[model samples]
Target chain A: MTTTLGRPGTRPSAARLGLYRAAIELKTFFRERDAVVFTFALPAVILALLGAIFDGVYPGSDVTSAEYLAPSMIAAGIASTTFVNLGTGIATDRDDGTLRRLRGAPMPPSAYVIGKILMALVVTVGETLLLLGIAVVAFDVRLPTDPARWFTFGWVFLLGTTACALAGIAASSLAGSARSAGAVMHLPYLVLAFVSGVFFTPVGALPGPLITLGSLFPLKWMAQGFRSVFLPDSILPQEVVPSWEHGRIALVLAAWCIGGMLLCLTTFRWHGRRGR
Target chain B: MTDTPAVRVRGLRKTYGDTLAVDGVDLDVAAGEVVALLGPNGAGKTSTIEILEGHRDRDAGEVRVLGHDPARAGLDWRTGIGIVTQDGADLTELTVREAVRHFARYYPEPRDPDDAIELVGLTGKADARVRTLSGGQRRRLDVAIGVVGRPRLLFLDEPTTGFDPQARRQFWALIRRLAADEGCTILLSTHYLEEAEALADRVAVIVDGRIVAAGTPATLGGRATARTLVRWADGRQETDDPAALVASLTRRYGGVVPGLTISRPSLEDVYLDLIGDPS
Candidate 1:
């Protein structure tokens, strides 16, 4: 029997509860050694490698390939960790009964959703910063000085991160177990990175069909946004536009973000397959 | 309202594909009562409990838990109910104390995390990660999480399935405390007849989604009034009163009857009979 008398219980506001859960999730994210390396270290390593092979200026462009690939890789890393990682993690929780427990608790379902989004965003932002640091040091890529470009990059980052995160959440329903979740989420992530021109870009010289196909994805828009910031004005002729395609990129990424969120809200499976 | 029971069910029904999981069963548990739902596997115990816990949608019939229809109840209503599911969910990389503390935040009136852990006799391993705990220990953790909310109504689905005898006894004691001290109403399902007799104020036997018998353990299926058997070295008699039969047998032997035994049917016997033969 409990010997110490407890104080009268107090109910935490829903928002407070959500932030608390998010805090714990963030802590767990860092503590899980594999996840930390996968989300944070793996991208930096890949970026460094990409920076090595393609760091020099492109034949038709003034900017080194690192300046171009930096943002694309950043987008790819965010997509992999936030979208794919969250997908598998959610699936594992479902398979293992965490979702069931949460469902039964007094906490709101939104609290769980909020916890995951916050976790994804926190890591996405952190990983982006780390990738930026590497781009600066290893590849000598410089941060954009123009306030206008920074503003554009900010919204592009937000839209792209959330779009991928929502897509991952939506895709989790397709997975029956954690093992299957990896393959289910990985396919689209890899496909998007490749088709979006995140890799092998200087897209002007690429096949017109490929560039058109890549333009449809948010990853491509995110990459273009970064290029606009890092590449000089002289590189405009080979770009998607003379400077930044801020309006078009924002429009596409935002549309994807809204569509993905709606899909997740409608189709997301909160419980495990066992219930069926 | 004080008159309302902790749980009330009327014509509860559920189905999985073509099979009925819970039939038109009616049950009621008064406030502060410990009611054990006893049945074999696939007997609809889990399905019924899940519906009552509001985790599953019932196909038909009316059900109320903690005075609200669980099917439509909101978080305010859920604040008073606790469930320790059949399978414990493993929270990766969190210590016992941390997990308990984390779940405690989800309730309106939660017990102190440390106190809840101690109540489950897990103080020794408070800091141990949940994955490292033994099966029994993790089960204890599950119970701790369930009770930390200080729920007015607690649902335990085969709570002691993996427990050793000592742990089972300890669990029974903890549940007794929850009932006796906090007036928490408990609805649990169990396979062990002893667990039913030791903890439940009443036992309800279910078979094939129907309650075949329900009463206090001694009186379940009229077990208390059932005939007793008196046996001696070479003779046996089924009678209402075994003491009189034993006395006559002693007199026939002009002393203590050799190999004398007065026995009545065990709860398990009546249970098997009610549910049909187990073998």
Candidate 2:
């Protein structure tokens, strides 16, 4: 019964711990057929539906309907996975006691958070690629030819998804139960998306208050950022600032990332039973 | 490990709003010992266990687990301890083997995942999805994850809450194996007296946020020295000397004592008395 494993100071580095956790989280997420289907498939379905009804209706700027909505759809896809999915996933884990058990493990708390964010990023990447594939093949939207535009797409996609993922994790703590996670997360996202014109292109008849309200959320800027990468330069006038506000978009989304990370660090609840 | 106690606590107290959950409780568990915290529901057993497992904050206490304060302990300190709490472990999506291997990577010196799963009698179901397993099987998986790190200490809170009779016995054997084979100190909390008697070298009884009794099962609350019950077919007498009473009963029965029975107060009786229950 004698042994020598009681050296309490021995542990792997935090990065190694986080990598393993991320692998496990992604494995589980990929295996859940329903989660994968809803996360990627639903967005593609909505795009197809939009492409069909708005056939030949170019929002008066010679912009094909599919080309007009491609970046917005992609932005919406990233938002759903990063915000709605991760938020509810975390809240469900809390309600079911998964976070408490993981908190008790030897791994660092940040490792768990990193693992979840990584999973959201993985889902976001897969869904974006799928939507873009559909847009190129089925909707006649041209894939970016220049490597420079591809680079813009990469950073915008990364920053947008990372910021939204952080928001999801931060907001998850406010949800009281798994059942409420979806609604709690979707309230702000849906409101912003509605005003930002995600479901429909608000062409020629832009209102003032909705534009201001949309400006307050990161999604408005994220969609514009992605459009800067995917759409033609002439389409910039449809945006609030009429041109690629690339620096502002990066700054605003980066702020959300910082703010969301702070919120998650300060307020995320590993134990759901704890009182406010 | 030899000189230091596996766990030590004094004047431990915790409160929730206006209610005191654990008030002035002291306890010690030596290394390699399996000490069971025995108490009924709402008796603060879970709260005490949670605090020791470092998942809950204590209001006041001088507590050390393996010579480290759990409240301020770091990952290295946590690596020496294993826990099977009921939450944030919705590993139901993974197979038993996958979950075990996943958790194993979190530890610096983890036991082979296969060995851990087999120890809990789940080797045959290693490929089974955790959600498909029965209640007892899930508990066994919990134990596998709890011990995968070859931890210096283990905290099992109501580990066998939903286990059947056979599963409970198997779980006890597994726990005994951990203490005997691995020299792992165990702090098992449960309301089942039989489980405490079967698994623990010492039992601590907590009731209404206070420890009313703590000792070995045979001597808990003076159970071993309590008055013995001497009985015949139709006669009964409560006496300290059962041998003398048996001798007199034999003589009255003319060399044979019919229906003769001699029994001391059971641990349950002493426990009931200590908790101030009339029955």
TM-scores for all candidates: the values are: 0.94, 0.94
**Native-to-model Cα distance after best TM-score fit, residue A82 in candidate 1, in Å:** 2.5
lDDT of 1 by residue, A79-131 (tens): 87788878887887788888889888888888888888898888888888889
**Against the true chain A, what TM-score does chain A of candidate 1 give?**
0.89
Alpha-carbon deviation at A2 in model 2, angstroms:
18
In model 2, the runs with Cα more than 4 Å from the true position are A1-5, A8-10, A203-206, B87-89
Clashing pairs in 1: none
- Fnat of each candidate: 0.49, 0.61
lDDT of each: 0.83, 0.83
**Per-structure clash totals for the candidates:** 0, 6
Interface RMSD to the true structure, each candidate: 7.6, 4.6
Residue A60 shift from truth in candidate 2, angstroms: 5.1
Task: lDDT for model 2, please.
Answer: 0.83
